[model samples]
Target: MQHLLGLYRASERDIALILQEAAVLKPALLSSPPQSFSFLNGKTVVLAFFENSTRTRTSFELAVRRLGGSILNFSAATSSLQKGETLLDTIANIEAMQVDAFVIRHGESGAAEIVAKHTRKVVINAGDGMHEHPTQALLDMFTLHETFGRLSGLHILILGDILHSRVARSNIFGLRKMRASVSVCAPPTLLPVGIEHFGVKVFADISQALEQCDAAIVLRLQLEREAAGFIPTLREYNTFFALTDEALSKVSHKIFVLHPGPVNREIELSSVVTDRDDTSGKSESLILRQVTNGVAVRMAVLKVLLYDRA
Candidate 1:
């Protein structure tokens, strides 16, 4: 439970404990003047992000501050990386300054693992290039647990740009570890090779994938990394892959919808379906819940990795 490189590194027991801790911490966070935990009172954590981010970076900063830990924001642009210092050398320089943990998001895959190998401090992978976003998966799992009350026997549909989504990879690992059935729906170009070997049924049609599913997680299309001719057009992709109000109507039973943030207006999910919610106003409009739970889940990870639980 030291460095969270990916969901594949975690056992089912480990996942359960992190989820339990997150559930316990979340209520305290929702308090009127949110209660401070201060578990990492004297520790220093460095947020080393080499990629642009909004939610994940902010959530981790809030998580650390809420727990009374000191954070040094590492900006790749302003740092000595521009001065030709090697990644490991830059990290070594930072480690020499008495940091306790490194929360990193890098454009390079295996960047966190490289840091983990070189540093004594804890390394929590915020994300790595098309590799894994482990905390996002944990928070998504927490959100799903809140909705379904259990992951076992639930058939979850992961819809959209699977080939480029680290979130998809992480979710697949976490969901399957908990005994939930997962199915992926994407355009033939968007679906990764050997994805079926991950124990998920792949579908070329979204409607067919949603038929027996209890919940759906719509993924944002990674247009930035996409090559020319990979997708014919945004209009064509939306016509088939977008989770719309019309699509949800086809499901016989009520089901929840989730999206990891920065959603394209009409690409991955439609506005109507995103706004729709259950009586408790929790199920369908779970994007904010996923964001909120992110802080709690990250808190649990930081506490577990940095503190002694004897």
Candidate 2:
């Protein structure tokens, strides 16, 4: 519980406790009369992001502030890293300031682990390359749990660029650990090697994957993957895999849709699907819920790591 590097490292009990805490905290976030907690009062948290992010970074910052903690935004562009300082060296210098915790997002896999290894302070992995994005997975789980009342035996399909998606890897670990039936749908070229061994069934046909699933999480196409020759073009990829309005109509059961944000308009998901509500009259923009739950989930994580409690 000291560090949330990946969901695979957390037991089912640990996951339950975090979600339970998030459930308690979420009410405060939505209260008409705003409320705040002082759980992290007198604590200082450093937001060290070596990667560009909008949702994750903003949510972590808001999580810390709402819990009454001081934050120091670390900018890699203007930092000593630009002057050839090693990642650890910069972190060591920051650690010298006696920060209570470090929320790190790095493009290199195991970067957060390295920080945790070298420092006595708590380290929460916001993201670390294609290895894991534990908090994102936690929020996604929270979103699902909030909607369906549980995760056990729920069929969830993660659709899109699997090869370069840290989100997919983390969700696969977290969802399966929660006893959800997890599957993935992606183009052959975009599917990573040995992904099926994670106890997830892989599907090339999007329609087949959508059938009978409780929910489908559409992923944003990683443009970098195209340069690497995993995909030929965005239009072609959309033709085969995009979650259009037409695709949702084919699903016989009531199915929900989830997407991690910064969505590609016509690529991973169609513009029509993103804006429309589901057949059940619920908002299809689970992306907004994901962003909202992110703060609560992160607050739960900070409480676990900082106070050793839910």
Candidate 3:
């Protein structure tokens, strides 16, 4: 077992095994009193998120706690990182305390890899700028597994800001590894110059990409990454790639929608689409389910990394 620093370093078999493990573990997680794994009984995890994160941070902390591990949370503003502390120095201080794992998210590309290179402790990249989000990709695979019972042969459309989305990059690799058909839909300006090298079809029109997809994932449009002249307005981007209810209806009826959140609401999707209850009406929403799956996926990741099974 080793640190999951990036999706490119992971093999197709590795992706399959984690998805399989998550499926088995998810049932136990929902049981009344909850099933627990004792593999982490005496371990300590340090969550070092340099960037602000609501779901990834909280869910990972919860996951570690549930596995009987303790966690230390550190934010950039509250720590010496704000004072120009090197990533090595910051991790070294934590490593001195015998931390078993460092779950990190930073705003610079390759920041997690640098920490991993310098630290003795296992490193998991929660995210690294626009590089990758391996855990998010795993959780997404878990969600797809639950829905389609298989990852292969499913047409998945990744829409919106592909140029700056670590989520899209991670999903493309993980999905490709699992033999799923993946496509990207975004305005030309919002896509990377040579992303087709990843082997996914690129589409400028959302409707054309959605027509044959079994699932569609909307990457959160990162306003912070937008340059002054990137686009004229958010409304213009939405008009082209946002998955409104009408837009969703144009896709296959079997399509399931996904978003890595802090959703931009009407900007990425209409309120009616996000608000509609499925026929069952019992499930609160898909967003929360994605959040929950994140914990399970990360748990599987931690277990595999530390327990030497994956």
Q: Give each model's whole-structure lDDT.
A: 0.88, 0.88, 0.82
Q: How many angstroms is residue 246 displaced in model 3 relative to the true structure, after the best TM-score fit?
A: 1.9
Worst 10 residues of 1 by lDDT: 276-285
lDDT of 1 at 245: 67
Per-residue lDDT value at 10 in model 3: 95
In model 3, state the lDDT of residue 263: 86
Q: Write candidate 1's Cα lDDT for 108-203 as tens digits.
A: 889999999999989999999999999999999999998779998899999998988899999999999999999999988888889999999988
Q: Model 2, 1-310: lDDT tens per residue?
A: 7788888798998899999999999999998775789999999999999999999999999999889999999999999999999999999999999899999999999999999999988999988998899899899999999999999989999999888888999999999999999999998888888988999998888779889578888888877777888888877888889988677767776667789888989888888778766556322657778888999999999988887642
lDDT of 2 at 299: 92
Clashes of 3: 0
Ranking by lDDT: 1, 2, 3
Q: Give the TM-scores of the predictions, in the order they appear.
A: 0.96, 0.96, 0.93
lDDT of 3 by residue, 205-240 (tens): 777887867777877876754456677788787777
User: Which residue pairs in candidate 2 have backbone atoms (N, alpha carbon, C) closer than 3 angstroms, thus clashing?
Assistant: none
